[model samples]
Target: MKKPTMTQTLLFILVIGIGLFYALKYGNKAKKDIAEFESKKETNTTTKEIIELKYFGEIDLNKTEEYIDVLTNINGNEISIDLNIIEETISKKTIQPTINFLENLHEIEKIAHKQVLSDFKNGNIVKDYIEHHIGEFNDDDLKSLGIKTTDSPKERKQKFLNKIYLKRIGFYPEEWDSLAIFDFTISRDLTQYLIVLSFDSNGKFVDIYTES
Candidate 1:
């Protein structure tokens, strides 16, 4: 075989040098990317630790399992605090505020319960109930219940309304029964009415209204 000339040898050496240079550059870049990812992961963990310590004092926030505790018992009503509920309903950005609210939940619960009852009494619950069921019964439906045909529409409606009466509070929607912080079930005899109360992450009462 013929030996390569000086120019070929020089070209080969230059190509090898370029390959090594790029290999080292990309290898270092990959290592740097990994290091940065690890650093960010560590920073996030540290931040979570700080937040837990700042807000919860001695409570262990890093528990891998579900955490639940009895929150308060007011007037025979036993309220429970479930970490899973807060984690699901509350956003990460508002987690701190939500935690702060939970810390004072015992007192807040009483106020919330009272306000809900007051609102139920003073609000449109009765009117809404009447309106909902009044149009439901036709002449045939009323007559089946032994109402006289001579009864006026106004009288027939009043008779229907008379049969209906608000039963009690503390009812929950079938689907969201376990989810809501507070649910007031209003019933007219056999029929069920739903009133859902919503609160913000900061534990401020947002609204209390009936759901269709």
Candidate 2:
């Protein structure tokens, strides 16, 4: 076989060097792509897990607004007066008086009446109420909380109402007409309470949940 000339040897070395450089560059790119893909996979898994853990199925925008309207209209023309009475009663920890007032309003459904009365008689005020985001529970979690799964969303909401006492209403400063505020006491002893019933900008019951 004929030996390669010096120029041919140089060209061969250059080609090998170029090939090695490109191989390293492309290999590193592939590794980075794989890492990014894995990160995305993990993020998607976390999101799916969160969705599966949700208790509330979906928010009914129309129904949410309708409830707000019903509560507001039934409270009468003086929204501020109703709000003040509620806020004051809750702040003073006068549980029965508030229950009576709420009953008279006939706005929202009757709350955990017996428990509220018992708490008041027992000198409990639900002062330790905490906030929670909606869909923070699965079926198992609802069962644990003594909340049975209902066939329909309406039934589910009704069941939730039956378990808690609505004590306060904090209307958004400007958009009072478009909101539903429920500050609930969840335990007979007033130890467990839901600090806020959240709503999204679209008046959807998205983050509605109770905090222990």
Question: How many clashes in each candidate?
Answer: 1, 0
Worst 10 residues of 1 by lDDT: 166-175
Q: How many backbone clashes does candidate 1 have?
A: 1
Using all chains and alpha carbons, the TM-scores for the candidates as numbered come to: 0.40, 0.30
Model 2 Cα lDDT, one tens digit per residue, 1-212: 99999999999999999999999999999999999999998865531111110112222221222112223433332221122222211212222233333334343323333333344345324221211311445676556555666546545544544455455554331233323355555444434545445332233343343455
Q: Candidate 1: which stretches are off by over 4 Å?
A: 1-46, 50-74, 78-108, 116-122, 130-181, 186-192, 197-207
User: Candidate 1: what lDDT?
Assistant: 0.51
For residues 1-212, write the lDDT of model 1, one tens digit per residue. 99999999999999999999999999999999999999998866632222342222433333322344334454455433344332313233434555556566556566666665565357765346545654564556556555556977667545644443222222111223232255443233333555556555556666766664
lDDT of 2 at 100: 35
The residue pairs in collision within model 1 are 171-185
